[model samples]
Target: MAKDKKYRKKKLGSYPLASVVFSVTLALFVMGLFGLLIITTQNLTQLIQENIEVQVFLQKNLSENEVVKITKILSSKDYVNKKAGVPQLALITKEEAAETFIAETGEDFVEFLGDNPLRDVITVKISPDFQATENLAEIKKEIGFIRGVYEVTYIENLVHSINKNVKKISYVLIGFTVILLFTVVILINNTIKLALFSQRFLIRSMQLVGATSSFIRKPFLSRASMFGLTSGVLASALLWGLLQLVSSEVEGMMELLHLEQLLILGGSLLLVGLLVGFMSTFAAIKKYMKMSLDELY
Candidate 1:
């Protein structure tokens, strides 16, 4: 009976299991929240970048064949955006442009001018990497020089402003991420250390009974690693639930959620949890092992 009781105590260890699990879960939850924020911000930035369009005005009276040829040339350029293996370039006829303008402004400009003055335009959405102001100016000049092209224009000021703001946002997010990562490491480390504090006597007892340091640390590390994995899984589930709730409540949110990015974030959290748990457990065991009996008391 006495030996069985001792065995059970050793198997359970001396850590506060519930407290450790809760603490680790809370830390991972905060980290996952920040990960979601970063992913959503990237998606939002991409959406804005994709909306920046450049108008390629063609020379007036170009035949249908010429217009088709111009579109093919523009689509082949490296600067253009591509989705699903196709270039995001659309050709708009002068008549269609005029009709759209009239419908938007609620004015019959065609009646006043007695002719369509708008040129057939190829609306090009540039790749996000090439949306810089200088790159755009070079692109405009290059496209303007293309045969059968009349003018190449875009909202230059808007593009410059977007780039400037995006740079600032990126800097801010980077700083925040660094600080958050540091905080998370410290928090998890402290939690694991505290949990191990109650096990100091057990560790010392095993050491005194001819147990190697690795033997003494093995079970504690294993339990801590399990704690980490469990906490990470719980945190990820909570994050997914929160996202699903938000998507259901908010219109257009489903469009912003990237499942691939979310999966990567979840996997990263699990790995971080395992790493921090094992390292912290190992450190704590080493510290307790080095302490004299008087200090441990």
Candidate 2:
């Protein structure tokens, strides 16, 4: 009984360095990947929100009142999710439009023409979610049906191309993450198995001395759970440190890790680390518990 207790304590104490390295490395790897996922989603959302442009070219002879009425109709579409959906209609007056053209081209062509040939154009900034050609096509058809709209100009092919590329990149990243996760699990399993190898003899000795398999396995299970908990805490700390460095120095890189949410994410990561340790330990012990004394040699 005394020998068994000493043996369990000795086993737990023997592999501190290896366990620390394994826990820290695994935590950093997973946390880095998770951070990447967060950044991608945020940047994509921003890009989508900013890139929708829908142009409504008004008829050359429309009155100012008619132009204002058309602008109101375009602004009221429910699909424009006030916040993340469709942006407000921006009215570009003919004089401002002419000035823009002059500034852009540096040509005095409008002066040569002697009249403002440009009509009032309403610019619609759609949200990224509704930037698809099909959605734009429907919007175009609806607006074109209006009496005073001469044309609705939007580049459908470009939006389609961007969406397709984003989807492909997302799929590739997802696949790589799954593969890396599996590889980490296996690596941790092997590390734990090596750490627990010395206990095989102790387990057999306990069994031979009239100890039930459950009694013999209990001490190892408890030790495993303890190791798992400790490792989980260590891993979470390492991840938190990494995040802190990024947030402080990277400047506008990881604003998502602001104080409150960062604390929550760290707490969640600690739980995850603990689970990884516990499960890996349980699995390693279960394999040994099934081994016969003859197999220990």
Q: Specify the poorest-scoring 10-residue window by lDDT in model 2.
A: 12-21
Candidate 1 lDDT, 15-121, residue by residue in tens: 77799889988999999999989888989999999889899999998888988898989999999999998999999898898889999999999999898888998
Candidate 2 residue-wise lDDT, 194-275, digit = tens = 7778767766666678888667666655665566556656666776677668768877656443565556656655565556
Best TM-score goes to which candidate? 1
Candidate 1 clash pair list: none
Scored against the true structure, residue 49 in model 1 reaches a CA lDDT of 99
Model 1 weakest lDDT span, ten residues long? 7-16
- Name the best candidate (by lDDT): 1
Count of steric clashes across candidates, in order: 0, 1
TM-score of 2: 0.75
Q: How far is candidate 2 from the true structure (C-alpha RMSD, Å)?
A: 4.3
Predictions in order: lDDT:
0.90, 0.69
- Deviation in Å, model 2, residue 53 alpha carbon: 2.2
